[model samples]
Target chain A: MKAIAVEPGAGDPVVVEKPVPEPAAGEALVRTLRVGVDGTDHEVIRGAHGELPAGSDRLVLGHEAVGVVEDPNGTDLERGEVVAPTVRRPPNGTNEYFERGEPDMAPEGAYLERGIVGAHGFMAEYFTSPAETLVPVPPELAELGFLVEPISITEKALEHAQAARSTVHWEPESAIVLGNGSLGLVTLAMFEEVLDIERTYCLGKRDRPDPSIDLIDDLGGTYIDSRETSVPEIPDAHEPMDLVYEATGYAKHPFDTVEALAPNGVGALVGVPDDWSFEIDGGRLHRELVLHNKALVGTVNSNRGHFEAAVDTLASIPGWVTDDLVTGVYGLDEFERAFERNESVIKTAVEFDTR
Target chain B: MKAIAVEPGAGDPVVVEKPVPEPAAGEALVRTLRVGVDGTDHEVIRGAHGELPAGSDRLVLGHEAVGVVEDPNGTDLERGEVVAPTVRRPPNGTNEYFERGEPDMAPEGAYLERGIVGAHGFMAEYFTSPAETLVPVPPELAELGFLVEPISITEKALEHAQAARSTVHWEPESAIVLGNGSLGLVTLAMFEEVLDIERTYCLGKRDRPDPSIDLIDDLGGTYIDSRETSVPEIPDAHEPMDLVYEATGYAKHPFDTVEALAPNGVGALVGVPDDWSFEIDGGRLHRELVLHNKALVGTVNSNRGHFEAAVDTLASIPGWVTDDLVTGVYGLDEFERAFERNESVIKTAVEFDTR
Candidate 1:
């Protein structure tokens, strides 16, 4: 079997040969079909963050993956069926969150993220996982199934945002995305496909003619250039936003988005900003939050329910959006090319063959 | 008639003569019995903030007040019935929030606070307000009724905190109040009276034997002298907090409190900090918010329902606490003495002969 491994602290990654894994009872052996390359993967590769497998010098490097079930050892899953393996698994021992089927809500260091923390990822040719951790996807959408993980992130965030605003009769009329990356585009697509929002906007630093902007425009959403227009000035230029989805990973955009919200607004933060300190008008920000009844919530990974919802969301959206967004697909030998930054690239994947 | 007025920009305040107000249709002529003085009143008097009433050189300086209805003017209010008047009123035109009975959610500059903004207040011998804005207090608790307005502020903040955590089955066991001011004392009282929280702590810079600390201790909650301990060191010294009610108005306490929250905690911010900027570890703060499933919500003035709730909250609390808290009750001529800040004073009020 071929797998990509990175040293824990060393920012070097290479493809190496590994023995194929076998499924234990109630587990399934999944042959990789395609794995999405995201920012977290780059972070792990650069040794900025991520944990190594226990007693191993290296960690496998992919969490967003789709695969074919080659062996369902006494499980309900059928052979040759498509599935998206969940990234995180509960650590050995019974935790309250894991027992309640909410491993995502587990406290810090409680659960191990496959290929991210203390376990192997799905970038290998063959991997074994508990059958319950595998979510079925349509066979006709094998390549596109890799996106379910990222979309699930937004699904969980939206679920929390909806819950936070449930006390008030809030029906969001206008929404804005604070980033133009693939997650932002997918979030905008979800806003169009799943939510009842009417007006939409996506803000990014890129200029016009970019695929991200074109896709936003195709979804009947406006694209705002962040380089030309500042965030605080958006509400005045357009209308005060009801819902703000922030994915820029900028330390200041979330605060700025808080200022841009209308009365009774909610800001859903998915981006993890850098360790930078900047001066903020604490008084003014406090006033906006208190007087206007605004709420800001942060969400990271998704639970099984959110992933299940993401499958439905992905299936309902027009296929062209996914086809247009997943701009590049490479092979095992060309895996490094998938990590390269390109202005036109929305998403890229590394496909696999089990034969 | 006599009223306390402050020159908008000048910090000087004095008792001045004014025409007695008459009740119009659906309005009540209230004979003010007691006016509780809080920090916002000090801010208004110091010229740090506050707006003058239209076409007047001076602004009446009180928002936390209790009065007796002298003239019901064909409204539901009865003569000699005790009432607490709400501070904020809707703007001239019919705004959506005011129409929907949520004047507290009105946009900035859309609503006018009675003493803090462009409207006159209830610090006079007589005043008139729409009968709808007057929440009735039990005639038995006349002087104690002035505490209702400040109590309503906390009631609103707790409501927002409960709403934000409504998604999860959160039952907080321990809580902490950030400041030891009048609002903090009232919030501590409410936590013991309204919620099922067992362990409680109030952080303040005051020395022991202070009335505020005494009240907190009497309520079976611990008092932490913040001069000896820093904000971030609280949870380490005691225990991680599930609910943090911030009323210190210090610019940095809320951020440090974010670091002190336990998993699935909620911080209800009712404090309006000064215009000071401080450096914060934005990355760590974002991680805490995302990973721990914590939420921080800010709340300001309360609406009619909150006032109604506050009335019940005040009634349910023991009479001795209010008696100990409202330490000073000056006559109309000695009203200037009410504004003086003294170490022994927990709450000061101006009383009038309304009988």
Candidate 2:
């Protein structure tokens, strides 16, 4: 079986040969069809984030995955059924968070993400997972099913952002996404189509004629160049934002989002930045948050419920939008193209098999 | 009528004589009884914060007030009724926040806090306010009704902190208050008595025999001397906190509170800090918040609903606790004693008239 693997503190991911995995009791063997590459994958390759599996030198490198159940092994899943595997699994086989069906809320060292940290991922041709960890995906959407994982992240982030205002009669009219990456564009689309936000904006440093910005315009969203106007100055440059979705992971965006918010506004933080120390007006930020009745909620990862929600969101998004997002889908023999970074690229994936 | 007034950027408050005020069509003339002094009063005196009423050189200084309605002037309030006045009023004739019955959520400049910012306070012997701004109080609570204003501030903060967890099943077992001032002590008592939080803690940097420490001990809360254990170190020294109530306006406490929270914890920030610049590990704090599913909510002034809630909270507290909190109740002639800051003082107020 062919698999994608990365050596911590080493170079980029490479194609490796490994034996096919067998399903244990109450487990299902899956034959991979598609796997997505994201920012976390880049970080894991650079040694800035994620841990290698215990006693293993190289870690498998895919979490956003979709496949067919090759063997159900007497589980609820049926043979040849399409499914998407969730990333997080209890590290010690049990914890309060896992017991509560909220593994996404588990603290560090309590859970391991397959292909992310402390476990092997599903970038291989064959992988085995507990039957319950697999979420059934509609067979007709197999071509785009790999996206359910990334979309789930946004689903969880928005869930928390809305939860912050549950006590108030909040009707958010405007929103801004702090990044122009694939996730940002997808979230901006969700903001327009699902949330029906009146005014939408996305921030990026890209020049005109960029596909990402074009997609924003196609979705009726305005694109603000970061070099021209920063996050904190957005209120004066445009309008006070009712919701600020931060996906850039820039250390300053969190503070800036507090200032950009209108009264009773909430900001959802999803980016994970590296160690960076800087000077900030702590008192001013604190005063802004307190005086404005603003809230900031930090979220990462997603649970099964979010993934279920993501399926519907993915289904509702126009086909052309997803078509524009996936710029390249490389086969195992030419896997290098999936890891390539280019200005024109929006989203990339590695194809294991079509059927 | 005699009043306590401060000339902004000048010096401490001084006694001034003015004509008794007349109530407008929908206004009520209140005979001030007890007006509590707090940190915001100190800031207004130092010219560091707050605004003087338009076209007025001096600002009357008292917002935490309880009084008797001297005249109803064709309003819903009855004459001779005990009431506590809310502080915030729309700066303009009206705003959306005020229209929605949420003046506390109004942004800066949209609202004026009576006595604290753009309007005359209740420190005067006679003050005029719109009848709707006064919340009726039980006559038996007249001696302790002045505490309602400050208690309502905490009420609003806790409301927001709890609202942040509305989406999840949160049972906060342990809580910590990050200050030992009057507000901190009152909030600690509320956590134990009202919220029924177990394993309460309060942080202060005072020597033994301190009155504040004694009150915390009386409430069955552990006292953490901040000099011995910093805010971020509370998790290791004591235990990870499920709820962190920040009352000290120290700029660093906000960031430290994020680090001190347990997984799925939420923090409520109530203190207003002055403009100060500081260095922090922005990346680590951001990561901690996102990965641990933590949230931070900032709250300031409270609405009438919170004041009504505070009335109940105040009545439920033991009489000895409120008695021990109000260290002094100075008359007009000895008003300086109420503004004095010393080691033994827990809470202070100025009495305009007993009847």
Query: What TM-score would every model get versus the actual structure?
Result: 0.92, 0.95
Residue A238 of model 1: what lDDT?
Answer: 87
lDDT of 1 by residue, A157-234 (tens): 888777777755688999999998889999999998778589999998887678988999999998988877788888
Residue B78 displacement in candidate 2 (angstroms):
3.8
- TM for candidate 1 is 0.92
Worst 10 residues of 1 chain A by lDDT: A282-291
| Candidate 2 whole-model C-alpha lDDT, 0 to 1 | 0.91
Best by DockQ: 2
Reference-based TM-score, model 2: 0.95
Q: What's the DockQ for every one of the candidates? A: 0.51, 0.74
* Candidate 1 global CA lDDT score: 0.84
Candidate 1: share of reference interface contacts reproduced:
0.57
Per-residue lDDT for B1-355 in model 2, tens only? 8999999779999999888999988899999989999988999999988999999899999999999999999998988999999999989799998888888888788899988789988899989988888998899999788899999999999988898887676899989999999999999999999899989999999998989999999999999999999999999998999999999988778888898999889999998887899998988888777888889898989999999999999999888788878899999989999999988999999998876
Q: Where does candidate 2 stray beyond 4 Å?
A: none
